[model samples]
Target: MAQWLAAQPKTIVVQPTTLCPMDCTYCYLLERHLKQEMTPQVASAVADGIGPSWEPVEVVWHGGEPLAVGLTRFVELLQPFESLRQARRVRHKVQTGGGRPITDAWCDVFEQYEIGVGVSIDGPRELNHHRVDRGGRPMFDRTIAGIETLKRRCIPFTVLAVVSQDGTGQAAQVLDFMRDLGTSWVGFNIEAKEGANSDGQTPSIDHARQFWRDTFEWCRRNNDVTVREVSNLLGFLGLTQERRDADSQHDPIPTIAWNGDVVLLSPELLGVRSVTYDDFVAGNVLEDDLSAIVQRSDELLYVQEFTNALETCKQTCEFFSFCQGAHAGDRFFEHGTFAVTETDHCRNSVQAPVLALAELLQAKGSR
Candidate 1:
């Protein structure tokens, strides 16, 4: 169990830069405006840390904006992991805002590397008021234009929409909107109070639960599309006692920042610092060894605090068997400490969705 707990993540999130073209209202990044980019040296060091002995990993290209990093520079960062890709030891995905024009050049690169793409858009144009530019102007059309380009080039993409207060009861509207947009894959992320996003509203618990229920129904009725959250919810509901124990163990999701600094558990911990935990940095790929840092993750102060909080969760949170102290960043960003449990994320992403699925199941059984 100790050995399994100490293993690295199957998915590693790598930030290429801190420059985003659009500033979504609920973005958690503190350094999203800076132009600092990851050096090729840092990329090489990260690749070395993964090594050939490790299992295959999904390398997620994330940033203030991944596509905003420019094609040449983004390719340079990915170059280090080329061998892994060739060996079928690595897969890639990039989460982009699609605020800037996504041209054939980007599509060519996506095809060349087989990078899975995810675009962030909040429902229809009217609901997209929350996604704005540097000048605080809504650019919903601009994002749609990029999606259009992807479609023209026959590049498939997954849409990630934030389910904030404005989107509470409008799940069917959002799903219908996405259906017209021609997306076959969609994901909903509940906006929460975290990082630089202090004002993110938690939808009334009932609204949130209903949102999930409706979303699940939509996907079930419409055979062409699937929702990521629903998939996870279904998977969790099917877990056996032994399976839950094994899957409950936290994977060391190592997120490497532009300069190679590593943060364990959550990407939201990138720029946050606490007086108690100081910076939640586990180590730096440039200075410290990534594999060693992850292996000894328990030594970090915030991790120790999280361990204690998770123990508390077993006693307090009824969803502990499924959640297992799932979101470390949510706990810290919401309460300003990891020695706590039951965050806004816990309710919106975990409990509410779980209950919603159960309710749907009950109704189906009655039928």
Candidate 2:
């Protein structure tokens, strides 16, 4: 627990605004309708809270749709980090829905800041129908147009696709679609029940396991576009086999809400309200130092319970070394508590991929 408190967050997720153009069915942001934007004061407080770090820190501009704040207002929000950026101590990244609103000015800002952009497009039209506009219209064409704009401007960006049950079976198609869009990197996020969307359906453990296996095989053959999940699993498994102390180090990741409220660990825990813990909010950047907030959160009962669960996992679970107890938000949402280990999320996301990759290696050895 001391090490956890001492660990400085490498990334700070900043939600600029709750407003969004599209209404993805499985979105975790329950308050997406609210037009609330993070105040400049709040932004300044976040900048001050983070202060100086020895290593480069990433400020991820995330939201219902970060671009929904518009290009001009977005630049204004980034003003507080300019000094840090100039010093090469901090960098900016944005996770956007890649709707119809992207403009040349946005690309200029991206180039100026060297923002690592990640566009959220769930493959082609058939797969992306779930991520629709407010009027329930598919945004595939508009999203692709935004991707084209980024490409034309010579901006390298990553694609993040949310895999639903409907789209999980089409691994080859998803791979081809992403490659055709000219993205060098693709990350898949499985739909989970969280925040306001408790009814969201996750593919069955078996289905998800098969999907990952198929996806990994396809990516292995293609070798051009990087599949984030498969690559990460392979890296962790391949590297950590010789290192015993890998699971002991836990880095805190702070998520700053529109109002300056900070939540440690999973960013998905920020906006979510729970009967047991209220809202997992450690503290506010305006009122407390980041170090103080993290220390205080260590005293929280839920945090303690989550820590205990992770310790148990370290002792009990075979994949604990690679996964490091997995994401707390998923545990709370799926199993109603963090004291438990191995949810369906774990099976599909971590365990299944690991098993699949190992089997592939075994087959190669036999051959």
Candidate 3:
């Protein structure tokens, strides 16, 4: 086998570009960024710096709309990383809002390279009411058109549906929409305040509990297509022996913003404060050593108290083994600090274990 990229980043999330055309009401990055673009040189530096050194690392292009970075830019950014795939296995993933069709060359990269994409479209029209562009128009039709393009071209893709408060009562309908999309896997994220989503309109605890129960039951019925949010738990229970606890407060995995600033371990760190300054400590990968930059930034005394508190949550909570702590940005936005236990995350994440046990007991009683 060829040598792996050296950084040991099992998953590397890069903001390929920070230019997004959508102006959704609940965008998490809205508070944190305007429209900074990631230069090809900076992207090349990031790829060279953190391409995994051992195991196959997954590369995820996250953005205001990664597609906004354009096909030429994407090609330039991906060239170095692609060379690694030429030698060994390097998985590439992109999280996009699906507002634009990828150019033909980009499609070639998707096919020629081992790239998987996750498109953001909440659900059907009613469920997607909040996913609109700046003109305050519904984007479901255009988003669906983009999805169809991927399907027609046989591009591997997944859907990430944000479950809105209004859509909580219709989990089945929303799920059905995803199934119709013809993807093998899908993710359902509860709308939380982050990025531009500052209205504090996450689902009520009661509703979230019911939604997860129903969603889980739906999965039990299907037995096929995978669900990202829940399967992370099932993977822990039935497969991996690694520490599966969400509350476990280990150092966060690394995430790279458009400017090449590295946010260790927390995906939420990208835009939780100033659009440019929040969660940022810099090393221009194009000019500096990525590892040295990480080492120095890791030493900064920003969230020590919060990290200690998270350790307590992991060690003490009943569902610690199953719950991953909310990203620091999520905790900060929802609870104001990384160390503070996120009551809502606790409630939502705790429901599955409680419900699973109840179902087991009911089955035993019936037997």
Task: Name the top lDDT candidate.
Answer: 1
Cα error of candidate 3 at position 223, Å:
2.8
Better of 1 and 3 by TM-score: 1
Question: Alpha-carbon error at 312 in model 2, in Å?
Answer: 1.1
Please write out the lDDT profile of model 2 over residues 1-367, one tens digit for every residue: 7643336767889999988878888888878888889988889888877745436788999987899887778888899989988988889999999653667899999999889999999887888877888899988888878888888999999989988888778888999988988989998887778776679888887777777878988988898899988888767656745574565555567889899898877787867788888888888988988656765777676677778888888889998877877777788888778789888788888887888777778988999
Candidate 1 residue lDDT tens string, 66-135: 8878889889988988998989999999998875678999999999999999999989888888899989
Q: Which stretches of candidate 2 lie over 4 Å from their true place?
A: 4-6, 365-367
lDDT (0-100) at residue 190 of candidate 1?
A: 87
Candidate 2 overall lDDT versus native: 0.82
Q: Between candidates 2 and 3, name the one with more favorable TM-score.
A: 2
Top TM-score prediction, candidate number: 2
Full ranking by TM-score: 2, 1, 3
Model 3 lDDT tens row, 304-365: 54455556766676665666444456666666655576565556545543555466558769
**Could you tell me which 10 consecutive residues in candidate 3 have the lowest summed lDDT?**
1-10
